[model samples]
Target: MRQRLIGGIGRLLAGLRSPPHAVLAHAVFPADEPLSTLPCVALDTETTGLNVLRDRIVSIGALRLSGGSRDNTPPLDYLVHPGIRIPARSSAIHGISDTDVAYAPSFALVAPSLLGYWQRRVLVGHNIAFDLAILRHEAERIRLPFHPPAAALDIGLLYAGLKPRVATITLEAIAADFGVTVDGRHTALGDAETAARIWSHLLPALSRLGVATLGTARSLMAKQRDLLHGQAGAGWAIGDLLPPHRGPQHEGAPHG
Candidate 1:
């Protein structure tokens, strides 16, 4: 599995004219590596709007969780100047005004560090496809090759998969269901901390569903492809997860 991961990333790297420092050769992990042993980074992005084609990321929040540690690494929060006027309605939702980001760095300036920090860790978040999409756009705008983490988990999708009958799967709803406190509701870092907590709470449930490893989690999330596509309609910015297949000769792994 490790070799397969290496080969897969190698192929991707070979295609890149110049893979950035973010594309570390050692970032890829074995498919069957246990989830509990793998580090995870909970991420969130506050954007200008819902349209991936036009909107830009205004802020990014990410925190590293070592071996699924409840106490996560110090969080990284960046406010970005999106180079366009921030809509008043959008500002009303996230509380990030033009003045707030007036002195902030542009996405191009932040991309290297942000992508580097995100490399080699499983990315977890609530309805994360949208966040991933926004980041992909930012990377493309800067002509940076966005090589996302080997795996990404969506708490909303995971919850929906486990409790298919539930109607509400909002970030607030999922955090509330898991008794996670919502301190930073709209801010990137605050939401990321909440997501990390929700992921910690959801781990046991995931295990019970037979999703014990990164590969199995990939399988589980793949089942939520429809939901993922709906979240990131452009399709290009969604699902940074490694495919379930180990090789062409083998069938795709069993879904969680």
Candidate 2:
């Protein structure tokens, strides 16, 4: 899997295709302290494939960023049976065979915990759209309509913007540039850790550049993602969580 990730990247540099352009959007940005001080979760997901509309989520990892700075909390990760067989090729990349998830809890069994961790907060990730798509699908699968976060930011965009001279900015590049090590290249927790490292490097630099505002950072992230698809306002959807369900606090309990 390690070689696979490395080789896949190698081909891109060897001129396999034109590297995707990362265009960050222009938007209203305030100072950095509010965004930096707020609580956020750095998240990642390993899916059955790149197509979230069709692919199932196989695993999820999130590291909470607290105290308005980059020190992340203990990571939260989970493996789940996606109710479909894991494709051999996909499993080969992630190294998670079907048997590895055979008896794993379904998403439902763990959604509350997921919500408990993620409920009503800003979020951060490397390529956050990929993770957000998986999160939206996972929520939709169980009839839970998930609106995106009120504020969200991507370390990938921040890194790209900060490094105007780097012609290419992949996660590996960003990690290498910042001296951050990725221990588990394909694992969910590993990816989340990498994302955090990316943030740790980028955010402080942004602060130094007089770009310490959260609103500005999040707006730029959305613009950068939209640029991927030749669209605008692509990344700024706000998902104010729905009110608590009109039911009991615990399963099998009466409604309030």
Candidate 3:
């Protein structure tokens, strides 16, 4: 009886093994034909509320992206107290109440330091457009010359390309499905760190599936945006194009 049980388990394991013919089909994220390599920042923003035009970012989080193929800096982070009162609902999500930010400097005061870290680097986030929108709004509000980072990326969007038929996609869902830790639940810095870790992990599946480079990933985002939204003229639709939206039509920002 024991022998039979062992044999049954062996067969189950064998059934799970990759087919021999298809094994080794995809290597690491193979370099793309164009866009050799570049710096990337997995970034996140925490806001007082969700309105691209009205809500304010209370904190900013980021981690430097790295892979064996590139030499990049270690992780870094920042926090900004948006010059506004934090609504009760918003405070609950991020744990940043108006009292917490009252002593914190305004976005203008903190922009230079963050900008110094991000210039010429690609931006990454889960649902990155929200981060980008908040960042863009704050920068522009300070009259800081706002230029899109070298590029903006959404791991949430990228994952969809890897598994297009998935019925639903959310950060928590992806983490659970892929055996990743959902650390730092809602904090911007914690979330950014998680985003970077996820990107590192998902690259293998992505490379195998032909999302082998930054350009390919960005291209996928643009095309997917068209499919999902089905028309343009929406501000904040692109990277940091607008603020995160908690309310209806406060403003429709595009995907990053």
Candidate 4:
């Protein structure tokens, strides 16, 4: 308890001491704009492990959406060469072998392009905090400027709001409920595409709930986070909800 308290305080102090540019890099969005009209991107990442503090991102997949339509532009996909060896445990989950990424470009080499792809766009994902945290960690490691998007959306949180009684909120569960097919389950691009499809289904539901803007979506997500945090305690980690292995159908398939 004491260590956690101290760590929280230290993080507070660090944020307080950060430069003005750093503080304002994540610009807030207008609350009244309809979400349907805004530019958005769905992203997913495969990493060395679940610990953001310790894990390294081995792959990234992202696709853009405009005005509720899929943009035909090529998706951003990359295999990153994490400095350390990819652990077998994580490999069993994501299927990213060390040899697969041994010759890939490092995160630093790809950071600029990734940042550009994310610029001025809202980010969406299933359990998105993990991906954002990993991205932030990589940015810090490479001494690159990174500010989170002003408005980020989580598919899991949206589903929970839509069906508060549902006990499980995994990607597969949500996909099943919406009759969405999830191809490429463990791979980053596959997961990203699935997340994008989920978002398409979620927007109308959110609209029906009077959450028609980025601001409202963010507000609801904040409330859900608070409720979950209260129920699970402050120490709860989001990555804990992610399955460590692929489902039966995806078993033995190559991951991102």
Error of 1 at 27 (Å): 2.1
Q: Per-residue lDDT tens digits of candidate 1, residues 153-172?
A: 77777888788788888888
TM-score versus the correct structure, for each prediction = 0.82, 0.72, 0.74, 0.78
For residues 1-256, write the lDDT of model 2, one tens digit per residue.
3443343234323322322221111123233536556667777778787665668877777777763354533456677678888888999888787777776667765455555555455677766756776677777888964545545676666665676566656678788888988778888878887887777667677778656667566545444332333211232112211112311121231111
The stretch of ten residues in a row with the least summed lDDT in candidate 1 is 246-255
The lDDT leader among the candidates is: 1
Better of 1 and 4 by TM-score: 1
Q: Clashes in model 4: which pairs?
A: none
lDDT of each: 0.73, 0.60, 0.62, 0.71
| lDDT, residue 221, model 3 | 64
Q: Write the per-residue lDDT of candidate 3 for residues 104-132, one digit (tens) a residue.
A: 55676555555555566667778776667
Global lDDT for candidate 4?
Answer: 0.71
The candidate, 3 or 4, that scores higher on lDDT is 4
**Error in Å for residue 150 of model 1:** 2.0
Model 3 regions lying over 4 Å from their true place? 1-37, 68-74, 226-235, 239-256
- Residue-level lDDT tens digits of model 4 in 1-256: 2342344334334434545544444444577768887788888999998776788998888888874667985677677789999999989988888877866767876665666666677788887766887788888888877756655677887788788888888899999998889998888878999999988888888899998987677666655644445323322223222222311221131111
Pairs with backbone N, CA or C atoms under 3 Å apart (clashes), candidate 3:
132-240, 133-240, 133-242, 236-241, 236-242, 236-254, 237-254
- Which residue runs of candidate 4 sit more than 4 Å off their true CA positions? 1-28, 226-256
Question: Candidate 3, after superposition: displacement of residue 103 in Å?
Answer: 1.4
